[model samples]
Target: YYNAIMACGLDSQDALEIFRLCIYDKQFIDTATLKDSQMQLKGRAASGVVFVANAALSVASITGDMSVVSEVITDLSSIGAKMNSESIRHIVRALGNIGDCEMILALLICLRGQDFANDLM
Candidate 1:
């Protein structure tokens, strides 16, 4: 996604808005309070590039097809430290829909670097 964004020679911010409009043109998430999302993920480029993580997570959760994004999810988790707290939170919440213990173990591996406190989690 970021690659495409860069390839278009866009100024990042404007291009994101334009891209969102092109994709979610008919659908709106509403301007009301973002109770479930963090504002930081709006523009924060995790992995020093882009965190299209939200799009990947949403597709998996909404479609109830974990396989749709399992690899991407794992990649995101593997580089969890490079991501913001909100991005990781998004991944966890999305995976929560699956309620799988294997995912817990996978997340634990990533969370280990985040905190020994998380060892209790």
Candidate 2:
């Protein structure tokens, strides 16, 4: 749930505060909570594609969970999300935050079909 909130592009400080609160009460935390967050975020129809892509990268940075990040990326691709050079820059920064070489490599592979390679170069 905390991860998903951060993935919604909330400010880092706000997300951290919510994370602490959620951790303080473990009784209501469950897998369904995570699913709910994802559903809610995905249901947002007005957000830009770049925002959603960055949110996915933020999720990767916060949780270090590849599965959730992969799901977000896959969903974005499936929806044909429009990402520009700026979005790539933001994702690179988030990847730096993750500091996982394997994840970076995986992202590279996952993005091979996208048009941002030139932007990355």
Candidate 3:
């Protein structure tokens, strides 16, 4: 599913479906499943991450609810140390894309007092 998104030029809609499936489906059993799809996003060269990030934003845009977006950001922020740089960047970018004022503030608060500078900034 992730690979398919990349093959399609990082199709946001497809990526969103993958994100929804990961969240709603109990059948998906993998370490990556727990992480936001954005966290696993790769660049255009890598492709996978690009689609996943686009998908997340598309989902947020369509729903107008921050549930999925917040989950991804919170999960990513909480587990920032465990993720790679690219993953963390994607997670942050996802948050930024959502453009939710409340969520952005909350994330900022959570980031406070943390030693890691890159994830929050």
RMSD of each: 12.0, 9.9, 7.3
Q: What's the lDDT for all of these models?
A: 0.44, 0.50, 0.46
Best by TM-score: 2
lDDT: worst 10-residue window of model 1: 27-36
Looking at model 3, residue 98 earns an lDDT score of 57
Q: Which candidate, 1 or 2, has the higher TM-score?
A: 2
- What is the C-alpha lDDT profile of model 3 across 1-121, one tens digit per residue? 5544345443444545565554443444333454534454423332333234444544454434345545544543443323333443454555676565676567557667654434335
Query: How do the residues 49-98 of candidate 2 rate in per-residue lDDT, one tens digit apiece?
Result: 43434555464555454444455555556544554554455455566666
What ordering of candidates by TM-score runs from best to worst?
A: 2, 1, 3
TM-score of 3: 0.36
Task: At residue 69, give the lDDT of candidate 1.
Answer: 45
Q: Ten residues in a row with the worst lDDT in model 2?
A: 41-50
Q: Which 10-residue window in model 3 sums to the lowest lDDT?
A: 42-51
TM-score of 1: 0.38
* Model 2 spans with C-alpha error above 4 angstroms: 1-47, 82-99, 102-115
Q: Quote the RMSD, in angstroms, for model 1.
A: 12.0
Using all chains and alpha carbons, the TM-scores for the candidates as numbered come to 0.38, 0.41, 0.36
Q: Candidate 2, overall lDDT?
A: 0.50
